[model samples]
Target: MLAQTALAGATSFRPLRFSDDGTFQISIFKDLHFGKSKDLVSYNNDRNSITVLNTILNAESPDLVVLNGDLITGENGFLENATVYIDQIIGPLVDRGLTWASMYGNHDHQYNLSAEALLEREQSYANARTQRMVSGHDAGVSNYYLPVYGSDGSSDPKLLLWFFDSRGGNYFRELDKSGNIVPQPNWYNKTIPLLAFVHIPTNASLAAQTVVGIDANSKPGINNNVPLAQQGQGWCEDGTNSNDCAYGGQDIPFIKALVKTPGVLGVFSGHDHGNTWCYKWDSELQLPGVGGGNGLNLCFGQHSGYGGYGSWIRGSRQLLLSEEALGRGELDTWIRLESGDVVGSVSLNGTYGEDLYPATPNDMTHS
Candidate 1:
């Protein structure tokens, strides 16, 4: 069931419940941005990322590993950079037989590659079938959703995972092409158990329209329905990187529409690295952590660019959720370093989850 509330100077989110009957383990991270610029990919960072990734693969041996987005940097617009990064840097793991899943980020598509060029890049991968692209879709469409069912392929299923290609699954596409962003719903929504992944945060709830809660400053910017920034979320600092979406503009609307559909156990996202607290999104306020430190049936995700691999942002909540934990009405969602050490973890706050507002005439709503 869902819950809600609102306040004068506060922004809230709807909470969710994840099933506790299955043993599902997952590893999620984003913004590796390999091949972006020589300066960005120093040996130290690369080696650090490699160490952390290797540790995660060994320690958790999770049923699944999800690289949220921005796996490679395509600044100069070379599809080969993406290819080389994954193939040489990460593809080695594929040969070692590690089951992993990935999503496309804005950087990957920002390169402005032609469809033919993209096809060639896809061809480089042996399991290209597993990867789905949203290049040649009609207007207002990016990529379709892919359902992930547990660890066992031909046996019992454990969890239902939904991977959305936000940013239209590519960076800014040509006008004729659907811009960078995806999560297309051509046919009706399918009925499947799901924990969704989007690249951005929605936005401050509609009620926040009049209220500027907690250090909230009104910056000048245009926001996309997803996490992309149209103008800019807030004011930029002197000489700051203003090229990216400052906030998850339309994330709020997307969540409301998705949750209303049912079968959406929870939604996990990356994009916002600074704010990483587990809170219950409701009509009143967003409560941090699980309901009583003993909640279950739901969880949210995030953490991008840890300054280095094997590390998490300061003030971020670390978690570890497993099937056994969920069965006990506990999701082993833990926060840890890239080195695979459990730094600090949050207990599930099983408060009933709900969307604070649905289609309210505000920024995050009615996108």
Candidate 2:
């Protein structure tokens, strides 16, 4: 039933991307489950995630910022309550200067520490020159391949990021047992290409299907056991069991292993909470954000959809890429909202069609 495309059925709102010779402008904020803010929906903490990150860094001052994931809904599910809300809300946006990167959802590793106490809780919540620019496999890791340069992005052919993990099988039962839902073949063979990141969303990253057979080998066993499902319950896609891992998992082998491979460009995720957004596997380009509202969004205000805390506001968008888009098309994510001052753009490529949100004060109803 996944039909309704234009940013995949636009509701919560988010689709920002600019880089077609436009120099820079990166602002991606997903699943700000900032320590479950007080559940039962509209969840937000870390002071409402730093007051919605200082009102979107002073209303879009961004050069770059990607907090894309349930940055801690770890609650009683544990991992030190999602590393104390990532050491107080995503480590101070990389200590103030911004230009950041982080990915992991399904309540950021829910809890359960082994694998050396989850690698010593990922080295006491990494962030020291972003853990020495992703140490290349260890030396106090932060997962690697950052490069945000235009002077500041450190190094390594700049702008090629990949911070994947996507583990969290519902804390072994509502969050803990040393957390980990999936995606760990040594972090999937140390992913490559120009991009990568996951917090969950690899049921072949949804093109939606599986009425029966071939939907990435349908399975709801997510490598075994369970969390919270029910869309046909055997991981949908026609389940009769046989080792179900949730129909089309591992996002179709992690997008067939990095879109086109060489210098990969994009791939990001953040559980499916609500106030959603998409563009799962971009062969090159088409990098989008925000998808946290499946819990049950009672309108923008979220009664509980995706557990709440969903906000979206934009002013511009339109990427139109293609330096031969890695694997030939599928990466034109879109989103823009400003409402009254007049601004609108929300085309999530279900074959494009949004002039930009609902209009008049950027209204898209819902709430």
Candidate 3:
């Protein structure tokens, strides 16, 4: 049914370009559970997760690659084997012409396809811009926004990348019995220092992991514990209890539009397949009765496929940025692994303490 005005008077998209050393790398490949059970050992573990996503895009030569959702593993009875595991998870980012985008995991339309058939197989990929649901409340469908230009390639954009579609399942409904689900309000417009990629991790990421806590590759307190996602289910809240996939925790106006949007600084997710961390949501920890803004940064991603279930170890999540680190508004992230080993080296908007490396200043250009 896909046509909610198919982006009516569409605007915004066709920006994300930056790399003649002005920098703008990103890479977050999340859960890739590929065809849940299409056998042949799940297509040889999604072809060894596309050879660990082509050795991290030929060693981090990224200017974008965020198939940040489950990238397949639907319950398939053969919707063309979910388009052959979504063309083997975007055939190594379309054989390296690279510039990519995607989001939507709740087992990505669980079985036989239908998040408008994975948004019509990612709009036949010409490096997918990933946006849909022209209006609102079809619950979710990869909300848009992706501008990053600058290195004299400007038409206005220093950096900004927001993509939401945290939908997969659970249709909240419980106005009574104290199983809450009443709060709802939203807003968004103009923001920078941003970086959001969703596929479930709201509930203000469990109130920013209860004011900055869980990190050594996550999952400590809060009952939405990651990995295999069944013991209470990963983050987000409100609990009407439909076997707790922890749905969007009543969303609270998209977590108050990510704490009043403008300069968000962080917010990344992936259906908790053994959580990799990056906390700090401190705007003085609100949400006690829900309402407040200016707290940003909350991360998770590093489950880079292998057909999910997590023994930990598969990786992804990178970032980078530049143009004098976005003119010192900060950016530079990490997580690599798949045996290349880089690990949680944070610094987006500066300091959440992981391993701090910081030093890649040579490329500079912004005008």
Candidate-wise lDDT, in order: 0.40, 0.37, 0.62
| Model 3 CA lDDT for position 279 | 62
lDDT of 1 by residue, 279-315 (tens): 3344444322211211112222434342322233311
Compute each candidate's TM-score over C-alphas: 0.59, 0.27, 0.31
Best by lDDT: 3
Arrange candidates by TM-score, descending. 1, 3, 2
lDDT by residue for model 3 over 182-297, one digit each (tens)? 32211122232477777767666665555544544332111234322321243345443453444434556566666776777777877876566666566556765456545466
Where does candidate 3 have its weakest 10-residue lDDT segment?
A: 358-367
Instruction: Give the C-alpha miss distance for residue 212 in model 1, angstroms.
Output: 10
TM-score, cand. 1 vs. native: 0.59
Q: RMSDs, each prediction?
A: 14.2, 21.4, 19.4
- Per-residue lDDT tens digits for candidate 2, residues 200-289, read 544333332122111111111011112312111224333233245444232333444554356544455445433233322222222222
What alpha-carbon RMSD in Å does predicted model 2 have with respect to the real structure?
21.4
Better of 1 and 3 by TM-score: 1
Rank order by lDDT, top first?
A: 3, 1, 2
- In angstroms, the error of model 2 at 344 is 33
